[model samples]
Structure formats: C-alpha cells, structure tokens
Target: MSTSFTHIFNGDSTAEAYAHSGLEGQEFVWREMVVQGPSKGIPGQESFFGPRRTYFQKELGMSAESYYSLTEEEWHRMAGASRRGEWVLWYEYDVFCQFNLIALLAGIHYWDNPPDRLSLICVGEDENHRWNTLANFSPDQYPKLLDTRKGLTHDDLLYAATVWEAFIQKAPLGLLPFAQTPHPSFPYLGLAIGYYLRQFPQAHNGLNTLEDILLQEIAQSPKTQPQLIRQVLLQRNHPFGFGDLQWMWYMKKLQPLWLQEDDHLSLTNLGKKVLEGDTVYREHLAGRHFGGATALDYIWEEDREEIRPFPEK
Candidate 1:
C-alpha cells in the first residue's frame, strides 16, 4: 500500500481547523475528501504536504497557522514532500512506527487543554496498527482525560504499551529500541526475547541467550509461563523446529497477557519492557559467537548463501 492514504482531513471544518492549527505543514499529504464527513478516501491529485509545518509544531510548539504564516511561498516550496520525507515517514510509520510518539504523548497530555479541546492527530507511516490502537483508546481514558481531569492509570499504560509495540515493531530504532523488519526471524527472535525477559525479571550480568537462560543455575526452580519460555529457549540448543515448537507451545498453551493472533502466536504486554531492557545490548554482550552453531543460524545461512558451510573452527 502507498504510504499516503485517503486524506483524512474529513469535513471542511476539520480540514480547515487542522490545516490552520498545525497539521498542514507536517509532511501530511492532503487531498479532497469524498462522502463529506469523515470519509475514508485516498489523497486526491491536488494534495499538498510539507515539513515546515511539522518542525514548527513539533519543535516550536507553535500553532499550525502561526507556523505556516511565517513561511512564504518559497518556504512552502522548500517544504514540499520529497522521496526523503516519504522514506523517513514510512520508516516511522510502516517499519518501526516510532513517529506516533507525537500523538501518543499528545493523547497522554490531553488533559492539559480545556475539557472540550480537540486536536488533530495525524497518520504516520504505520496507519493500520496506529489507527487501530487509537480507535481502541478513544473510548477509554484518552477521551475521559479530555472530559474529566483524571489521568491515565496502570491499565492504561498496559494498553498503551501493547499499542506501542504493535506499531513500534515497525518503527525506527531511535523511536523505539527494537526495530522489526519483514524478516521472519526478526519477530520470532523478538518473541523469544520477550518471553525470556518476562520470566527473569531480575537483571543479571554477562551475556545471555535463550539457551543460557534456560540452563542457568538459578532457573531450575518453578517460574511463570513467561519465564518458562525464556528458560527453555536459553537452555536448549536444538534443531530449527525447536524455536517454532517453543513459540507454538507458549503461544498455544500459555495464554499470556498479550494479544494473540490466529497464527498461534502472541504478543505480550511485557514486550515494551523487553524492548527497554536492551536486547541489542544483551546481544552485543553475548558476542558474535554466542548462539553457536544453532539450527536457526543454519537456516539463515542457507538463505543467504546456497552452501551451508559450518562455522570456522
């Protein structure tokens, strides 16, 4: 799908309001809306977008109109969408979804404004998951924060974390710690790491892996389902099927707190926690040879090169 979608400017009122407010200049491609009120339509041929508005609103906290007024036609011309802008936004929305930090923070701070204050939320590259999460949240604490003075609670954080990861998995690393790629192994590795960290909540020194974690001297004792997954992965060094097996076992039998899909895989609330826990750091600590000659590496090797030579001794 195109990174650009139906210009969600909605009605003229919302369009004009948001256009004047601060959204128009933020690299948002605007087009004529069909079906009038809140119609979901793609951007039209006459659409326009630029970055001047984005920088003004984001960095200066200026209103959209105030920011736009500063720009002459020349400035606006410079701000127009380019391939670079599209790529950057796409990475933020499509691949890593870190760009929604703006909206999420705004939603979190919605109460700072008057009770009836409405802000225009933009669509980043990862509109699918981002929009879905927003729709789910709109009915909950966010609107309530606007209606009342109450702040978000732990449950809200949990929900937000899930929503955060669902999009963040596609976002950039600077926006979030973990960057999910289209690679199949990437998410699988993520799921494994998430499972491990949830169980061994305590911080430990030195390099660690699913195998190291499972066979640890401390792991023999009983653990939560989250911990079990980690321990199993860290302790066992088996065939490629083992990874899938463990994933299936936990996702199928465990019934974790995170959301599940029909594919028999699940994403847990603790994913963000794991993301924050420095999986990359841990990977770095584990050294290049930590995983050893595992089945997982074998498949990756086969895919990268037809010959599956064993690792250098």
Candidate 2:
C-alpha cells in the first residue's frame, strides 16, 4: 500500500494526460486558485471581458487582414485551460496577499540576495528558525517604508533557500517538458532530480543498490516501465512505434538512468545524488544509482492538487 503525491497545474491538459496514461488505480483530486481578475468599464460591468482587442492590435500593429486571421477560439481555449488551474486569483490590490507573501519569501531565497523592489522583499530569515516577519504587520507599524512586516533572518533565509530550491525542483516541467526548441528538458530534469535528493536527506549514502532505488520510485508512482515509456511518447506527440525513437532516448537512456544490465532498470549512486539534490544533467552522466531510493522524478501543479506531500512548513 504505497501512496504517491502529485500537483497538476490546472491550466493545461495535465488531467487528461494522466487520465490517459494507462497507470492503474491512480487516485486524483482537483482544486482551483485564481490568478487574474476581470476587466473593467463595460456595459455589463463584467470583469471577465478584456477592455478591447484594440490594445493588442495597436501593440502588434496588425492590419485589418491580419486581425481577422487570428483564431480567437483556439487562442481562447488555450488561455482558458491554463487559467482554470490557478490556486489564487489576484488583482492589482492586496486581497490575496499571503501567497504573494510566500512567493516573495521564495524569490528572496531563490536569488540569494535582497531584492531591488521593496514590495517583493517582505520575507526574511536567520540561522535559528525562519519567520514570516511580514505575516502580521499592519500599515501603522512602519510608516517609513509605508509597508508593514519585516524580512526573514539569516538562518531563516538559509533554511528557506534550501526549501525553495526543493520546491521548484519538484514542480512539473510544464511547457519546458514539451519545448522542442531550446531543449530545456535536460536541465529541468537535473533540477528535479537534485531536489528529490534534497527532499530525502536520509538516502544520502544508500547508493550501493541502484535497482532498489529505481524500484522505489516506480513503487511510489505505481507505474511500470512500459507505461512510463508510453506516457512520455504520448506527451511528445510522437508515433507509438514498436521501437522507433524509443531506442534512442526512452528505453536505454532514461531507463538506464535508474536500472542496470544485471537485472531491470535500477537506481545508482549517481541517481541517488541527483535525487538527493546534488544536481546532475543527462549529458554529464557519470555515476548513477537506482533502487528503493529513487524518488518521484517529475511533478506538475495539477497533479499536486490531488496528491500533496506532507505540509512541511
């Protein structure tokens, strides 16, 4: 009885993809977080409609012919699907300020330095315990900056930095997964593996058995190798040949990432390192590890809505 957690970004075909992936007995949940607000100044007073297409026309300098050529419905579906997944819908104001506060804290930890914008630098920390100093500050508290709450301390920031890295590392690759242009997949994969390592500090030295680690990842996700391969191929929009592109990347490479020739695909010491947060890319493959130590390597915001990690904070 093993359980795996995932967060699906609400705005994409994530649900459909996973639903169609052919993995058995996968339980799913869904939630919504608004990210944008409606437009203003309309006869219906509807915030949903944009002010006008005039701005887009002016900005792009589209001619009458070009303007008419735009596929409004196609564009609308794409935009609407994406918007459906947000966990928070915010306007120019501060109603949904807590998560924004969290994002600011996360950003500071990400950049490893104070931000240039004051509004963004609301969270801080130190060596001891991290504190959302900005959590409860009222406007009257600080008239100087005109903002409330302070930043995180040094220890707090360091801890947060570590956690922030892990958080982004675990998030789904999103457009990066389908990006056929610059090929950001390798780097993104590296970051994800690195974060997985960070998540499980206990498995740092348990690399002697790669097979066990790879098995562990599969056990958690409850997907077989063929199923995994099929999912990847389907996502890529490639032909599902017997062994077309499969031999090139999916079968040998990604599979070997966790498994070895001795048996099936397994985890390696290097794989453990990637899962533990040391960070390694596909091209820079030196050592690999697999076994029960292989953690979930990929995730998305939409999948996460249903299967969530234990809340650490």
Candidate 3:
C-alpha cells in the first residue's frame, strides 16, 4: 500500500532548492515546469503556440529551440507521473503561477483517467498573512508547509476548467464576469482576471490600467525608474504581479511618451495630455499584443465597465 508521490513545482528554482533540502524522501519524484508564457491556455497546441514561439525567439530574444525542448520534456514527465502517482502541486499565488496552475489542471482534466489523489500547496503569505512568495521560503521551511496541502475538490476542478476556457478566447471579454465572482480556492484569480482585462486599451484615455497608473504616479512626483517600479509594487491594492522584466517592458513601450531628466522619469507633453484625459494614448502606444488580441483590438470602456471589441477590419 505504499504511495508513489510525484511533486510538480511551478519553476526550476523552487524545485532545485527543495531537492537540496534533503527533506523529500527518496520515494518521491520531483518534476519542474516553467509555463509562464503568453501562449498558455490556448486550445490548439501548434496553431496557437506557433506564433508565440516565433515571438519569443524573434521579438523577446529567447532561445526557442532550448525553451521548447525543456517545456516538452517537463510536460511529458508531468503528464506521465499524474497517471501513476499521488500528484502534489507546488505553486505560488501570483498571476503567473495561477495561470499556469489553471492550465495544468485543464490538461489533467483532459486525460482519460488521471490520478485521483491530487493535492496542492500554494503559498502566498506568511504566518502573519504578510505578502510572501515561494522564494521567501528555505528548504527546511518547505517540509512543514507540505502538511498544509489540501486535496483537490470537484469545485476547484470546475473553476479551473471554466477559467481555462475563458482565458483562451480570442476576445478576453469572456473573462469579465468570472473576474466579478469570488474564487475561494484560488483567491488571487479574481484580481488576476481584472488585471488581464485592464490590459485592453482604456476607451477614453487609450491607456491600459497599468499604463495609466504609471502616468499618474509620474505626474504626482518624478522618480527614478527603480523608485517608480517600487512605488507601483507597493501600492495598497495593486493587481499586477509583474516582475521587474515585465515592468521594464511596459516602460520601454511608454518610452515614446516619457522624458527622462536628471535621472527622473516624467511624462512628455503628449503623455501629460493623455493623463489629463485631453487626448487618447492609443495612437502613441507601441505595438503591444496579448493572447490573440492586439492593443488596438479591444478597449476597456470605464463608463460601462465592459470590454468593447473594435470593428473588424
């Protein structure tokens, strides 16, 4: 009656760190997967991932050859282990990890007869309920957290399926209603969905929510790049779980409308006009796209609080 356990970590760093801890028994098998790309949750494997692969290579300067090699290996390993062992998922509670978790769950659900003993250990806070991440925990600290893992419930699976389907839609407006609902199992999901919706251009200002926040913060006080990034992350109820690289990507996108003087980041005349609601920022926006929609495809109309798709070309 010995249980074969397979631990699936969200990233290699966490998986490698835990392996060094010597806490995981020899009986346990560890697998790591990094699925933090824009192509996640898409229905078709090749058709959807093909463009993203090229974008990661040509646009993002990532090595597509090596990236997909590792991804395919890990995906197969996890898929195989899920059929044979007690599956334990180790994930963080951020937009990145939550999306990966949903995608993984959807994959598992698609299997004809997946393992029933699925458990999850998602960490997002410390004992005091302070914001924290898996990187905050040491190897010795992980074993204790494993005890907190809970069995996956039917409701959790249903929610994951629904979210996965909505996320892959060509039009992200499919996610708006779900964002309004409370997800107890995945608490951060609602906020993540809201954050995703805000990626669309703002109807009046033509700036996404994050872009608007950046402009507003810069208008209040000119700060260095690092200072502005810190301020945005420290906001009381910030929804974005973007890392420094992602933040820099947005900064790069808005550079055309910003002015750097005395090492401080400030808005240009056009930026100020957009901030004041006197002019729309869409035309100035760099060619940024998300999922299957470009920045020009849809707009988040604040007055109606709905995503309006642009007229088809």
Comparing 1 and 2 by TM-score, which wins? 2
Instruction: Supply candidate 1's per-residue lDDT for 90.
Output: 13
Highest TM-score against the true fold, candidate: 3
Tens-place lDDT per residue, model 3, 256-310, is 6799999998889999898888987776444556654566788887777668887
- The sequence of per-residue lDDT tens digits that candidate 1 reaches over residues 32-112 is 111001111111111111333443354335567764443333233323423221211111111112212222322233222
lDDT score for residue 246 of model 1: 36
Given candidate 2, what's the lDDT at residue 281? 31
Candidate 1 residue spans exceeding 4 A from truth:
1-139, 142-208, 217-220, 224-310
Error of 2 at 197 (Å): 8.1
TM-scores for all candidates: the values are 0.18, 0.20, 0.80
lDDT for model 1 comes to 0.28
Candidate with the larger TM-score of 1 and 3: 3
- Model 2 misplaced stretches (Cα beyond 4 Å): 1-11, 14-200, 207-213, 217-224, 228-313
Q: Write the per-residue lDDT of candidate 2 for residues 148-173, one digit (tens) a residue.
A: 22323544444433333333333322
Each prediction's number of clashing residue pairs: 22, 73, 0
* Cα-based lDDT for every prediction: 0.28, 0.29, 0.70
Choose 2 or 3, whichever is better by TM-score: 3
TM-score rank order: 3, 2, 1
lDDT of 2: 0.29
